[model samples]
Target: MTAVEYEENESKLMRKAKENPFVPAGILGCFAIVAYRLMKMKNRGDTKMSVHLIHMRVAAQGFVVGAMTLGVVYSMYKEYVLQPAAAQKALEQKTALEK
Candidate 1:
């Protein structure tokens, strides 16, 4: 490909990386708030069972949020970065064969 096309492709990939960037940050913020609230409840002499339930809920929420964030990041990275690299390699090989 031409130099201009290569630069444009790189710019597109960077844009994809920056797109929807706030989602993971928001997820992490929610997790932090939930954890802090849970800690505060425990510190205020809440019942053991209630504390345990709160802990469980916080853990569940954290796990779900973590999984979702990871999934989104991985999918975006794979789609924008890894897939393009692989496709470029394949195209190069195909062009080499044609020549």
Candidate 2:
């Protein structure tokens, strides 16, 4: 992508990450744990690297699922809880005005 478009996309991603910081935090936590485990290993080789690759894939998938789950939950809360409360407040204010 062009540099300008890339920067816009990056900013959007940063905005979302700031909104729901947990997903990024979880991803960082997962990678840190895996890195620690790998460092602790005395024997490292092709086989070990392959196994760690699988672990990394699992961590990536976990991040995706966690992010999706958090997004869904946040959407539901905003729709069901916040919207209704806002509507209720507006209705109350309208009623007060009429009275």
Candidate 3:
């Protein structure tokens, strides 16, 4: 078989986004919050400004990490819990039909 390339991978990602709409929406919401906070900050350059900037950086990083963690957990639940349950139901139907 021929090897698949990057476009194929990109399409797969698009397909996932289509399947799970909330994942992208949550990411966008996180970015919007960060942008709003940054835009609303006062024009200052003293120590307080430095500390405030650091806090914003940390908050943005935490938001990104939280989004990633939620995505991973949701993916794990779908793969381990939902897929098996669907497969088992299909198998049961097939066995019943054969009998």
Leading candidate by lDDT = 3
- Among these predictions, the greatest TM-score belongs to 3
Instruction: Show where candidate 3 strays beyond 4 Å.
Output: 1-26, 43-47
Candidate 2 runs further than 4 Å off: 1-10, 18-23, 26-34, 37-47
Give lDDT tens digits, candidate 1, residues 28-90.
666776777667775666468676667657775776677567768876997899989999999
For model 3, the local distance difference test gives 0.72
- Clashes per candidate (backbone, < 3 Å): 0, 0, 0
Pick out the ten consecutive residues of candidate 2 with the lowest summed lDDT: 1-10
| Cα error, candidate 2, residue 25 (Å) | 3.4
Candidate 1 all-Cα RMSD: 8.9
Q: What C-alpha RMSD separates each model from the true structure?
A: 8.9, 6.2, 4.5
Query: What's the lDDT for all of these models?
Result: 0.67, 0.71, 0.72
Tens digits of per-residue lDDT, candidate 3, 1-99, equal 223234554666576575555567566767877787678576545648667778777777777677777777877898899999999999999999999
Query: What pairs collide in candidate 2?
Result: none
- What is residue 76's positional error in candidate 1, in angstroms? 1.3
lDDT of model 1 at position 97: 100
